[model samples]
Target: MEKEKAHESQNSKLTHENRFGLGSSEHVSIEHDPDDLWGDSRVIVNIGPTHPAMHGALRMVAKLNGETIESSYCQFGYTHRAKEKLGENRTYHQFVVYTDRLNYCSSLLNNVVYAMAVERLMGIEVPPRCTWIRMICCELARVIDHLICIGINAVDLGAFSYFLYGFHQREEAYTLIEKLCGARLTTSYTRIGGLMYDAPDGWEKEVKDWVVRTRKVIDEMDRLLTTNKIWCDRTQGVAIFTKEDCLSYSYSGPNARAAGIDIDLRRDQPCLFYRDVEFDVPIAKEGDVYARYRVRLEEIRQSLNIVAQCADKVKKGPIWSEDKRVKIPDKTLVHNTMEGMIHHFKFFMTGFDVPEGEAYTTFEAANGELGFYIVSKGAPRAHRMRIRGPSVYHYQGLDLMVRGEKIADLVAALGSINIIAGELDR
Candidate 1:
C-alpha cells in the first residue's frame, strides 16, 4: 500500500508543466521523475511519403516512446493513378498496359493475370504452347519479384553486397522478358486471347541456362546472408504477425505463408499449367522479418524449378486461341490483303467484345493471390474493373506489426512485406 502510494506520487510529479498554460513556448516541459524511464521521450515521428527506408510513397505516422514505436498508422495514395477507373474507360486489350504499372517489379505476372481474367470472361482457352509459355513467364516473373523484394529488404538493412547478387540475376531475367516483349519494366505481353508474340527459337534454352546460373547465385546469397550475426540480430523476431493477424488482414502469398498460412493459389486453386507443374510452397511459422525473407528466398528456388520444368514442357505450337473475335490479324495477311487490313484496323480501333457476364480470376502472382474482378456488359470494355493487389491488404497491417517494435524495425517490416506503392495506391 505504501509502495502504491509512492508510485502514484511519482506519476503525479511527472505531469507536463505546460498543461496549466504557464509557458509561452510551444514545447511541453515535463517534471522529471527519476523512476520514469519514458520521461519526455514520447513524440510523434512521420517516417515518409518520401523516405528511402519506405521503399515507396508510404507514410508511417508513429508515436514513439524513445526508440520504440508506441503506436502507429500508415498512409498511402500519394501516387494515385486511378488504374481501376481507367479500366472502365479503355478497351480490355488497352488496359493490359495499365496492369503492368501495378507491380512493375514483376509486370509479366500482372500481364498474365489480367489476360486470364479477360479470357475467362470470353470463355477462351489459349493453346497448350501458350499455356506452358505463360507458366514459364509467370514463374520467371515470380523469381524477379522475389529477388527485388529480398534484395531491397537487405538494402534497407545495410546488406548492400547481398542486393547485388540477386540484382544481376534480375537483370538477366529482364533481358529474357525484353526478348519476349520489346519492353522491360512495363511489359504488355499477354493479349486478351493469347500472347503478343511467341517465344523466340532458342528462348527456352536461354531461360534454362539463366535458371541454372540463378540457382548458383541464390545458393551463394543463402550462404552469405542467412547466418550473418548482424542480420539475425536485426531481423529475427522483429515485427512478428501471428497467423490470426494475417488471416484477419486478408494476407496471402509469401507474407501470409511466412505467418504459418499454407495457402498458395497455384496449389489450392490451380490455373493454367500450374496443375501440371510441381513446385513446393515454402512456409514459416515465425512471421517475423527474417521468416518473410527466408520464405521469399526458398520461393525463388522453387520458381527456378518451375521455370526449368516449363522450359522442357513447352513445344512449338500455336500461341493464340482460335477465337476470331479476339485474335489480332496476322501481319503478313494485313499487309497483303485489304480484308485483313480492315480487320486489323477494326481490331485495334474497337477492340474485341466480351460476353455479358462477370468473372473474377485470381492467380498466384509474385507477391500473393492477385485477383481481377471484371463485370462485363458484352462490350469492348468492362463495365467495372477491380484489382485486388496484395500490397494494400499487407500495408493495412503495418501499424499492428510495428507497434512495440523499434523504429528501425519498421523499415525491416515494410521491406519484408514488399509493398509496391503503385499497387498499394492504385
Candidate 2:
C-alpha cells in the first residue's frame, strides 16, 4: 500500500488529474436552467487529462448533444520529451537506446529505420545475413504491434475475451524477441553497420513454429470479431475518412490504406531484403473504423508470411559489414588481440564521424510510415534529427474524425489508428 501510494504521489506531481474521464483541476459548468433545457441543449463536456479514457497526460475536449459529439478538439504536448533534441546531442551509437522509446510497442522497427537513415548517410550496406535477420525482426515487431492494437481496441469496446486471446499471442511473440535480443520492449538491438549480434542457433525454426501457431490464433480472432454484429455496429461507418481526407491530413499506414491509399514503403520504395520477399499491402475502400480493423487483420497474416519466408532464407554468414569504423569486434577477438582491443575502445569512446551529409529513410511500420531524417556535419552527434511519426497526422485528424461520432465510437477509432503517445509527442 505504501509503495502504491508513493507511485501515485509521483504521478500526481506530474499531473494531478485522472478518473472517469475528468481532470482533477478542471470543473463542470452548467449554463441556464436544467429543466428548461432538458429536452434539447448542448453541454460542454470536458474529457480532461486525468480522465480514465484519456491518457493521464493527454485530453480530448468534445462538444456533445446528448450522447453524440457534434464537434471535437484535441489537446496535445502533454507528454513531450524533446526526443529529437536528445538525438542531436547524442552520438549515432548512443542514440540507438533512445529509438526504442519512440514507438515502444515496436521498438525494433524504430531501431532499424534510425540505423538505416544513418547507414544511408554513410553509404554502408550490411551483409546478406544481417539484412534477412533485420527483416525477421521487423516482421516480429509488426505482429506484436498489430496484436496489441487489435486486442486493446477490442477490450475498449467491451470485448474482454478477444483481448485476452490476442494478448496471449503477443506475449508468446515477446518471448521470441527476448531470445533474439536480451530485452523484449525498448530493444536497442540494431547498430549503425549491422545488428548487435547474429541470430542464435536454430532461431529460425522456433520462429517458424511461432509463425504457424500465430496464424491459427489470428484466424480464430478474425472469426470471433470480423463479422460479429456488436463489433460491426460499433465500428462500421464510424470515423469515416475519404482518400482526399487521408491525403489532406497526411495520413499513412493502415488508416490511409483503409481509405484506399496503396503506397507502402516496402513495395513502393523497397529496401533491405523487402524486394526479394513477397508480401501484400492490405487496402480497403470504406475508410471507416471497421475498414482500419480489417486492414490490420490482413497485415498480420502478411507479416507472418514474410517472417516465415525470411526464416527459410537466413543462413550462416557474417552478420556485420567489414566496415572497421562502424562494426564492433567480436569479444573473443578483443581479448586475444591488442589491435582489436584499441579499435573497440576508440569506437565507443570517440565514436565514428560521418562526412557532412543528410539522408531520409522511411519504413512501413506497424501503424504506418516511420521515417528518420539525419544530418551530419563531421560531428560525433547528428546536426539535426527528425522523426516522422504517423501519429502526428492521425492525431491531427482526430477532431475531424470524431465529429458527429458518439463518445463510445471515439475509443474504437483511436485504437484502430494505433496512436502511440511516445511517438506522437516526441
Candidate 3:
C-alpha cells in the first residue's frame, strides 16, 4: 500500500546518522504511524557509566516509550581490576588489601570474609577472642553499609537531610575502625589467623556508644521517611520485584528478604560467632522500593544489637592462632631482633603455604552473600580464586525490574539494590 511505503520511507530518514555523527537528528524525525503505537516515539537513553544518579561505574542503556522504559540492559566492568585474577597472582596475605576495594563502603566485611575463606582452606581455627572480634567488625560494617544504602536511596528521592542523619553515624563508626586498625575507609583489619591487631584499649566502649547514637538516628530516619507522603509516593509499590523473580535472578541479602525470601546466611548457615549471637532477620512481603528501604533500616538496628552483644561478650585473650605457619611475628620483635626481621622478610616475600585442598566460604555480608571459592595446590598463592559478590546477581535483575517503569524509578531501584562496581565487575 502507498501508506506502508510512506511510513517505511519516513523511518529510513529517521534512522540516518546525524551530521555530527551522533544518533538520528531531530530535524529529520518523522511522525508516528497510525498502525503502530510506538512508531518513531520510542527513543534510546543511556543512564550512565558516568551519570550522577548512578552510584558507581555502571551503565544502563534503555529504550524508552515516552517516560516509561520499554526495555533495558545493564553494562558493567568500567572499574574492573580483575580482582579474582589478582587473587591468583598475589599472596593470600597481600590480597587482603584488594578485598578492601571490593565494597569500599564496608571494606572491613570483605576483608573478614576473604580472610575467613583462606583460613578455612588452611584448616586454621582462630582463637575465640579473634572470632568474636571478627563478628563485631562484620556487624559494624553491615551497619555502615546499610546506612549508606538507605540514606543514599533517600537522597536519590530528594531527601538530602535524611542522608546526613545516617552519614554522621557512619563517620562515628569509622572512628572506631580507625582506633582498631589506624585506617577508616579501607581498613585492612583482618589477617589470616587473626586481625591486624586487637581492638585498642576502650575501643569496645566507643563502639557501644556509637551503637546507642546510631539507634536514635535510625529511629529519626524511620520517622522522617517511612510515613512522609512524598517519600511514600516515590517508593511505595514502585519497582516491585516479586519473590519468584528474585529467586530466578539469584537475589540474596536485604533485596531478597524484602521479597519475602526468608534467607539470612548468618542465620541459616552459621559461620564464626553467628551461632552464638542473638539477632533477628528482617523480612518484608511487598518487595517494592519502600520495602527494600524498610528492610535495610531494620537491618541497621539488628546490626547495632549484634555489635552491643559482641562488646559485652568479648574478653581479653589471644587474638591469633598458635599456628606458626599462619601467624605474623609481633611488630616489636620484628623491629628489634635480627631473627625476627629475617622471618618477617621471608614471610612477606615467600608467604606461607596452605594444605592441598579447596573450600568455598560464604558469609552474610552487607550487600548480600559474599563468597570466596579457593582451590589451593599447596602454594603461597591460590591456584584459582573466585569471589561471588552479590552485586553481580542483583545487577542482572535490573533490566527486568525497570521494564514498564518510568525513568526516575530506575534510579530508585538501582540505589535500593546497592550495586558496588568492584564486586559487580570482579
Candidate topping TM-score: 1
lDDT string, candidate 3, 109-213, tens digits: 999999999989988999988988999999999999998999898899899999999899999888899889999998999999998888888888888988898
Regions of candidate 3 where Cα sits further than 4 Å from its true position:
1-40
Candidate 3: lDDT of 30?
50
Best of the two (1, 3) by TM-score: 1
Query: Total clashes, candidate 3?
Result: 0
Evaluation by lDDT, superior candidate among 2 and 3: 3
Name the better of 1 and 2 by TM-score. 1
- What TM-score would each prediction reach against the true structure? 0.92, 0.89, 0.91
Model 2, position 169: C-alpha lDDT score:
86
lDDT of 2 by residue, 337-403 (tens): 9998998888888789988988888999887889898889988889999999888888899888888
Candidate rank order under TM-score? 1, 3, 2
Note the Cα lDDT for every prediction shown: 0.91, 0.86, 0.90
Return the number of clashes found in candidate 2.
Answer: 3
